[model samples]
Target: MRAHHDRAARALGVICEGGTEFWGWAGRTLGRAGTATDGRRVWLRMLTAREAKATGKLWDGNQTAEKAFGTLGGRRPELLAVHDAAETGVVYRAELSTRLDMPVVSPDPVLRSPLSLSPGWWGSLRTALSTVAGATTDRVAVRSAYVERALPEFVGAPAPETIEWVTVHGDLHWANLTQPRLRVLDWEGWGQGPRGYDQATLLAYSLLQPDTASCIRECFPELGTAATWAGEAVIVAELLQSVARGDNEELAPPLKAWAKQLRERARK
Candidate 1:
C-alpha cells in the first residue's frame, strides 16, 4: 500500500490522501498556487489508458460538437453563455455562463424547413430503422416506403452505398442543449457519414415541438433541399448505431413521434 501511495503521489506530483485517492485521477494538474484559504480553483485530471485509447476518436467528435454549439452561439449569441473550455481527457470541459430559458431555436432564423415535420425529420426515422434493422427479427416494424424512395435518391450521389456510414452525435437531445442560453456541450460519439444525422439524433431525443421543429429546419436552410437527404442518411446510420448499443424506448414520446414521421412520409 505504501508503494501504491508513493506511485500515486509521484504520478500526481503532490501528496494527496484521504478520499482524494478514490477521485481516480490519472495525472497531476498544476493549479494556482495560492493561500490555504483559497484552495485550488482549477483541477487536472489524470488520463487513463482507456481514456487515452478513446481520446483521439472522441476528440474529433468533440471538435465537431463544439462547432455545432459554436454555430448556435453564432446565430443566437445570447443563447449560449460560454464560460471556458480546455483540453481534458477525450472531451473538453466547456463551462456555460448561463442556461437557456426559451424554447429551442428550432424553425428559427437559421433552419428553413423546421426539423419537426420537415423531410429531414424522416431521416431520423429511417436512421432508427437502420439501427434496428440488423438486430430484431421484426423487420416489418421498421420498414418504410419513404426510405425505399429516399435510399434510391442517394444511390449514386457521391455517397456510400450501404447507408452504413455518416457523421453524427451518437447521443443528441435537449439535455445536451441548454435553453434560452442555447449552449450545446458534450461530445461523446461524433463522426461523419450521412447528413442531418446529428439534427435527427437531437430531435429524436428531445421530442421537439412541431413549430419549433419547423424553425430548426428554417434555421438551417441549407438542409431544406437535396442537402437534407445527406443529412437524413447520416441519421439513419446513427439510429442503427444507437440500437446496436441496446438503447430502447425509454423516451417513448420521441420514439413514437419518430415512428409516426416515417409512416407519414411513407404516405407521401
Candidate 2:
C-alpha cells in the first residue's frame, strides 16, 4: 500500500509540478485519495483508480461540478486535470480547491461525535441543496432499473405513488462534506435523481449515531414526509446491499435496525 501511495504521489507531482508536497492519504474501496500541494496556491487531490471499471466517459462528478460552478457557484472544488489510461483501466483525476479545516465528520461509520452543527450551517446546507436541485443535468447517476431491482429485496415491493425527480449530489455523506465553512466535495456522482435522495443518504449514514441522525431529521423534515419516502426507500436498499457485500461492516448493525424500522413504518 505504501508503494502504491508513493507511485500515486509521484504521478500527481508530475501532473502538477516537480515540487508537489504530500499532505495526507486514505485507502478506499474503489481507490485511494492523496492530498498534494504545489506550495503556494492550490491543493490537488490525486485519485488512484482501483475497482471502478472503465466504462463511461472520463469525467464524473468533477465534470458535473465544473459545469455547475459557472452558474450555481458556492463552495465546490474545481476540476484541474484528468489523466486517463484506457488500456490499463486506470484514471487519475486531479482537482484543485482551497484547503478545508476538517471534515464535518469522519467518513467511517465507526466514528462518532456529539452533534455540533449550528442552525446557520443547517440553513447553508439547505441553500446548497436548493442550488443543486434547481440545476440542470442530463446525466443519470442512479438508474431506475437498479433501484427497481434492489428495492424489492428489502422493502418487499414498492407502493404505487408518483416520485418527483431532481438534481442531487447523489453521493452526499459525511466525508464529502466539510465543516466550519461548509464546503461540499466529491462531485463524481452528481446528477438527476429522486428528490431528497441526498438528504436520505446523509440520514442513512448517520444511523450509527442516534443524536446525529435525529439532528439531521430535525433539520431536514423531508425525511419524514410521504413524498420523499420513495427516495428514502432507495437509500435503505442501497445501504442494505452494501451490508450484504461486506462493505461498511461497522454500520451494518445500525443500518439493519434502521432498515427494519423503515419497513415497519412504511407498512403503517
Candidate 3:
C-alpha cells in the first residue's frame, strides 16, 4: 500500500507484510502498518486532506503524544517520526509496542481472563491519566461549544460549567487499549479536554457487559461525579454522531439508553 503512495520512491517498497487498517470516516487509508526491512515493526498513519481538517492541528497532536511518551512510562508506544506528505497530509509512524499476553477484553469476544483487572493495573491506569493531565498541550480536543451543542441534541440540556478540562486521550476505547500489559495506542486525538472523558468513554464502550462497566466504575470512582456524567454525555453525543454517520450501529441502542439515563439525571 505504501508503494501506491509513491511508485518511484524506493523506501515505499521496503514496508513488509502486514495488513492495512482503514478509517472509513476519514475516507483514507490510515496507512500500511507492518514490519520494515530492518526488522522494525511500525504503524504509519496517513491523514488525507479532508481528514487533516477534521482532526484539527494534526501535527501538534503527534508532537504532544510524543512528548507524553517520555512521561507516560511504559504504557504507550514510542513515536518514531513524523513526516510531511505535501498534498496527502502528514504521515506519523510509531514503533508498535509489544501487546499484552492477554487480549483486550472489549469489542472482541476473544479468549481472555475475567473482566476484573488487578489493583496494580488500576494504579497504572491512574498514573497514566495523571501523567497526561499534567502534560502541557496547545490543542483543544472537544471544544466547550461542541459539548454544549451536542449535549442538547442527545440529553436536552446544556453541559454543566463546573466540569474541569484536562488533557485526555480523546479517542479512548477498547480498541485503542490493550489489557494485562495495559498499553494505550492511537495518539492522534490526544489533547486538552474534559476531565474523566477517557474514563467515561471506556465505561460507555463497556456498557454491553454490566460487569465490565461496574469494574471500570469501581476502578475509577471519579466516573460517578457530575463532571464525569457530563463527560459521559459528551461521549454519548459523539457515539450518536457516529451512528448517524453509519458507524457504530451495534452500539446505538445502548448509547441511546445511556444518554436517556443521563438526561433524566440532568432533569433533577
Candidate 4:
C-alpha cells in the first residue's frame, strides 16, 4: 500500500497526507504557501487490484447515479464541472468545493428514498434511456435482447409499451448517492429502458419493511402503483441479470426472495 501510495504521489505530485495511509495529493503551485495550505489540490485514489475490483462493483451498482449526474450536467450545464475522465474510469467529477469539503464518498438521496416508485422520476429515466438508445449505432435490439434473455421472468412479461420507456438509473441503491443535494454518480451501464426499472431496483434496495415500501410507493403516485407481482418480476430480473454474468453472493438472497414472491403471487 505504501509503495502504491508513493507511486500515485510521484505520478500526481502532491503532499500525500495521513502518512500515505489515506489517499490524497499535496503539491505546491507557488512557493511558501501557509495558512492557504494549497487548498487547490486533489487526491488520487490509491487502491490495490482487490480494492480496484471492489471499486468496480461499487461503480457497477451506482451506474445509474453516475448516469443521472451526466444527464443532469448535459441539461443543466451550469450545475457541474466537466472533468477529464480517464480511459478506464467513470466520467464527470462533481465540484466538491461547492459542497464545502464534501468529498465524493457518501451515498445519494435517490438511493435512500423509500421505494414508493415515483412517476416523477420517470422524466429523468426517460431522458437517460433516450440518451443511451440514441448513442448506440445499431445494437439496441441486441442489448434489449440481452436484458430479456438475462431476466426473462421479469422483463419478458413487461412488453415494450406496458413497461413504459424512460431513462432509468439501472443500478439505483444507497451507496450510489452523495449527501447534501443527493447528486447521483457512476455511469458505466446507464441506458434507456423501462419506466419502473428504477423503481423496482430502488424498492429492492430501500431496505425498508414491506409496509414501508407500500407507503413510499403511495408517496410518489405519479410513478404509478404496482402489483406485488410486478415487484417480484423486477427482483427476478435484477437477480438473473446480476448472476447470469456470474452468481454474485451479495445478490443471491434478495433474488431468491424475488423468485419466491413471483411464485407466490402467481399461485394467488
**TM-score of the candidate numbered 4?**
0.48
What does the lDDT come to for candidate 3? 0.66
lDDT of 3 by residue, 11-126 (tens): 33335344545452444545445554566665555544543454355445655677756526888766655444443554433223322345444544211234667778877888
In candidate 2 the C-alpha lDDT for residue 226 amounts to 71
What are the runs in model 3 whose C-alpha is more than 4 Å off?
4-15, 18-27, 31-39, 50-55, 87-117
Worst 10 residues of 2 by lDDT: 24-33
Q: Give the Cα lDDT of each candidate.
A: 0.38, 0.66, 0.66, 0.40
Candidate order, TM-score descending: 3, 2, 4, 1
Error of 3 at 181 (Å): 0.6
Q: List the residue pairs that clash in candidate 3.
A: none
lDDT of 2 by residue, 1-268 (tens): 3344345446655323345344333542123333455543344554555436533432456765777764245566555545443225555444455455465456553336665788887888888888889988887766788767877786555643567888888888887777776788777677878888899898888776788888888888888677677778788788778778987667777767766765676787
Ranking by lDDT: 3, 2, 4, 1
- What is candidate 1's lDDT per residue for 1-268, written digit by digit as tens? 2233334334434433334332222342211111111232222222223344534544343344444444432322221212222234432222221222344434221233333344544443344424422232211211234345544342222333344334344445554443443344334454443445555555444333557655545544544344445454434433444554665334444544444444344344
Error of 2 at 11 (Å): 9.4
* Model 1: lDDT to the true structure: 0.38
User: lDDT tens string, model 4, 1-268?
Assistant: 4443343344433444453233221420101111112454443332223323433432332333333344454421121222222324423221211112233322332233333334544344445433543442211111455444544454444323234444444555544443333334434345555545555665565433465455445543433334334433654576566666775445556566665655554455
For model 2, the stretches where C-alpha displacement exceeds 4 angstroms are 1-40, 48-58, 70-73, 81-89, 107-111, 159-161, 264-268
Report the number of the highest-TM-score candidate.
3
Model 3: how large is the Cα RMSD against the reference? 4.2
